[model samples]
Target: MTELTIVANIHAKPDQTGLVKTELLKLIPVTRKEPGCLRYDLHLDNDDPAHFMFYETWESRGLWQDHINAPHLADYKAATEGAIAEFTLSEMSLIG
Candidate 1:
């Protein structure tokens, strides 16, 4: 596969999961505009409402790096900092 994969596991503070999901939805359009972005999807855990995750496919690590530097990303990161209890990111490179 040619897609660069990123999985983000997020935990919202207290009852803020709903708000976090709403805010994360805003990233959809912005990600679509990036030249090398393939797909970006946000999902809520079936067993844990306060837990959220994002699956993103990019053209390369370079494009993903550009995403982190984008102005909107700072706000995105900031908005979720305290509101998010925990955050983990995993980057994946395809094989075969």
Candidate 2:
């Protein structure tokens, strides 16, 4: 299994931050139900609401790919369109 962790620092549009955050929060349940999805969590920076992080874990790369193709995920990307400034995704392998 390949573990993945994505830290997306989203610079949301001012005032629109709440909307974007709501949209981001919607992904949690959707992602958790996906095949091979171990965990899917969303967090907002206490000091900087514009900054958001998504910590996700999957069973494998293929499963992760499946998540990207999910309709809900697609909708999420579309819904959050102009509200986001940038998103950086990082994949990680857990060792312990």
- Candidate 2 residue runs with Cα over 4 Å from true position: none
Clashing pairs in 2: none
- Cα-based RMSD of candidate 2: 1.4
List TM-score per model, in order.
0.89, 0.89
Output the number of the lDDT-best candidate.
1
lDDT of candidate 1 at residue 60, scale 0 to 100? 85
The residue ranges of model 1 lying beyond 4 angstroms of the native Cα positions read none
Relative to the true structure, how large is the alpha-carbon lDDT of every model? 0.86, 0.81
- State each model's C-alpha RMSD to the native: 1.7, 1.4
Q: Write the per-residue lDDT of candidate 2 for residues 1-96, one digit (tens) a residue.
A: 557655456778777788898888898887888888888878788898788888877888888888889999899889988888777888878877
Candidate 1 per-residue lDDT, tens place, 1-96, comes to: 366899999899867887788788888888789878888888989999889899998998888889989877887887776788899999987786
What's the CA error at residue 89 for candidate 2, in Å? 0.4
